[model samples]
Target chain A: MSTFVGLYNYWIVIVLMMAGLYTVIAKGNLVKKVIGLNLFQTSVILFYVGMGKVEGGTAPILVHGDGAEEVVYSNPLPHVLMLTAIVVGIATTAVALALVVRLNEAYDSIEEDEILEQDPTT
Target chain B: MIAENLPVLPIVLPILAAPLCVILHRPRLAWPLAVAVAWATFGVCCALLARVLADGTISYQLGNWAPPFGIEFRVDSLNAWLMPLVSGVGALVLTYAPRSLAAEVARSRHGLLYGVYLLSMTGLLGMTVTGDAFNVFVFLEISSLSTYALVSMGPDRRSLMAGFRYLIMGAIGGTFFLIGVGLLYMKTGTLNMADLAERLPAVKDSRTVLAGLGFLATGLSLKIALFPLHLWLPSAYTFAPSAVTAFLAATATKVSVYIVLRFFFTIAGVGESLGNGAVREAIMLLALVGIFVASLVACFQQEVKRALAYSSVAQIGYILVGVTMLTVDGMTGALVHVFNHALMKGGLFMVLGCVVARVGGSRLSDLRGIGRRMPLTAIAFVIGGLGMIGVPATVGFVSKWYLVLGALEAGLWHVAAMMLVSSLLAVVYVWRVVEVMYFQEPEDAPEIDEAKTDEAPFGMLLPTLVMIGATIWFGLDTDLTVDVARRTAAMLLGGGS
Candidate 1:
């Protein structure tokens, strides 16, 4: 039963990773690429959060008289790390999306190839 | 309070300044504030480096939480050396940005440009000083995102395309790095670098560890723009605003190289049998290819910026070669070159910026006969060009000298020969620019404007000349940089391999 659940979780993560990677590689629009980057980063967060799970575990916070506890606790470190990563990921996406908006305004197009084609120096 | 807070100051000061710059909402105020913040960060880094040098190592736990649990900022001889390089360059670049920003960037957007520049500077410095493995990825993205923004600010439309390409590539690299870090976490159940280094040895031969290493090396190579993977660099540098190009060219990939060194040598445990003779040899071969092919390509470029961009790729090859040698001397060469290349390339690109400001472009043809017009600027360019070509008594020469010696020590005579051949190729590219600027008459020679003949504004020219002077100064008196690099190399090599 546990193996089945674990396998399902892994499958979901694999799909998320593949989806994010595909968008990053295939999308020509700069905004879409940043969205793809966010998606890619999010999948890693999901993977870490998944790994931190302990079946039937309570919060990692230690309570009084909890020595030799009846219930196991989820490892909280990955979740904490993910929180920092999530913040960073958001910052990156924000900055990247901002750049995309500026690029659109500057070049009058968000499409990558259009900008390249219209470049005067090239 | 100061002792407890020192570790986080390098990242926090600039991080806070970014929002402050935005709130101020005026370019004039933002420029001075950013410069002041950058210098403060540089001072903080210097203090941090001095502390690490004196104390051996300093570890700071965020929120007073103990590590393996909380995020850590660990400073040792390795990162202690790098902190100054990143922050010092940040301060120098900001000093030059005020006037250059006025000329190239639109006035309305100036505040935003300086804000992003400050953020990028904060991010790069943070990446170097953070001891948490996952934190490196976070800071990497911080710098990468801002870089795409900064690059897009170039007046030419091509800058948009260049920024776009760089964004795509940088995102892919960042994602790969994330995956690598995730795999390591899955295997070791820890994210702190010191904890991982402690744990990695036990799993040195494990498939998970090997896969993580593979992912990390590929990701970082892309970030460093190593050889064939460097497709986005030339265009990005060529089209980006001159100040932006100079700042990024000087420090960005060098910081990435620092990451590569940290992961491979420190976190991965350099003495692990899994990372043995065969792997080192393969890396060396790739470095050699990068050196020869990139230099040869650089020699034929007509645009001065594009040529320098390719030259940067070749210089990265030299650093990789130093790493591949795996000896103390070799690593020292690589570390010193990291500093030397920053000085020379920063100066060289600033010179190009001056030329761009004066003549309105960076094409080889436009620069013809400008040497007679702008003698000081042209002379500075020549000195920087010669430094790039590794003339004696320049910083570039010191780096190549150590690299050659490193190769010979490893009994790689053929590698040493390749280094010499690549230096000759550098001479070819350097000579192309010199001959154009000095030899050929200006296309419209008769109609000379006296105002244009004067050097760039004192602010712009002063920074360029200072960097040029540093390149020559460090080359002649290598004592300080050499000592720091030697200690850094020893630290990375795990107390003398």
Candidate 2:
């Protein structure tokens, strides 16, 4: 029970990841697939953020001038890395959504089944 | 001073220049700028490779920040060899792109296309040069996102569908890589690959490490389009504009294969879990199956470009087979084929680009009697096809020789037999195209004047001829390609430089 409690955030991440992957695989709607992709990426962000949290820690700041005191701080690097990851997620989502827009214009529908019916060689 | 900055220059030059094309929005100005940047980057890459051969591994600290903290650009024998190939192909494609782009892409969007091309090259070069694990993910997405846009720029509406599918698959693959990197970081608290390699051995037996390895392998295999994960590749390559196909067929997946080698051999050490038993057998089996299945499928394609796209999948199988063997000779074969396949495949796609420009379609019937109509282009295609079939005195034969030797050295006689059978399948596909082009009568042969030869423009034909010439030149003289591959493989398995 203690182990389960300790890894609860990881468990949540796994659940969200599987849900996103399932939606991506099962759904034929392109928009919904994009949403699923975002969900999958967001779960990774959550994993990193959760892993960076410390038991008894504050923001990673150095109190230097006069009141310098030793402080336990959460790791900040993972959060910083997650910021880059977030930007990449947005770029990928943008390209994917743009492709969806063009695909809709070309196929007259965003549904994969409808698009395939229109004689896409793929 | 310039020599000190060579490692980062290949990536930096184009990335900085990419946005300029978008900002200028002048196609004429943009094309020249992109060409100059590509050739300049190629020169830098060549210089860097020479420097590495003479001196050793060069690691450049970004902003003078140390490792395990800030990012670094690392060049060893392996990546130093690859950098030139990426930029060299970029330079040649840019030279061949003008007439081809005008034919397929719209006039207004040429600037945007060149910008994306440079961005893709920058991303591929960044993946080759960077030492940071997170940096690889960043560059992978950069390349992948641009690649989707490039594919979608094709005149065919189906290209949009193909691009969307590639985008979806690529996102999943990249996110998987990110998760793997994150897991590695969680266990070790470092994103530097060298540092990760040093620390990974301590937790090699941990479930976290195993899970990380699993995720990384699956993610990279998706990117490499290995067998079952290759659903996105054939359509993407077939539907993309011919120039984009030529550039990407030469470079993109090869970079992904490089990443697999870097992670498994360099960072992860390929020891207990990765090197033996199920993982090795699974990859080897997939590669062998991929070779036979994709080659057999290639024999049936109606569209010539689609057939070559399937053939690309089969060639990737040969490269992976060499990699999975884990012997120096095997690795040499893999690396050598990476160079050879890029030359032959890039050259063949350029031939198709010429055919599509002249003949207006890439179907088998469309190319009927092309040998008599466009004799020069047809001859180039035949020579490239012969290279693909592993004919003697061609680069393909050189790599295949090394591969069979590697298999025999590993005492895998059946694998050697399987490889030979697959080469025969290559013969069938090449014969199909040859028969269509050379043997069949052109539907409009009599309507046109028989004396006048309708060849592709000199600009496109020259690049195709150069690629074909290099194919023969490198085949006869194994000094440059085989030597570097041998040294790189030796360095990798003897523990990475």
For lDDT, the strongest prediction is 2
TM-score versus the correct structure, for each prediction:
0.93, 0.98
TM-score of chain B of each: 0.97, 0.99
Alpha-carbon DockQ of candidate 1: 0.49
* Candidate 2 residue lDDT tens string, B1-497: 78778788888899989999888778989999999999999999999999999998899998889987889889998899999999999899889998887788888999999999999999999999999999999999999999999999997899998998999899999999999998888898899998988998888888898898889989999999899889999999998999999999999999999999898889988674458678897999999999999999999999999999899999999999998887788889999999999999999999999999888888999999898888988988898999999999999999999999999998999999999989999999999999999889887656877788899999999998898888999999999999999988887777643
lDDT of 1 by residue, B343-403 (tens): 8998899989988887888889989887888898899989988888889999989898888
Candidate 1 lDDT over residue span A8-46, tens digit each: 877788788789889988988888888887888788788
Candidate 2 wrong stretches, greater than 4 Å: A64-70
lDDT of each residue in A1-122, candidate 2, tens digit only: 98789899999999999999998999999999999999999999999999898888888987576545657789999899999999999998999899899888877899999999997477
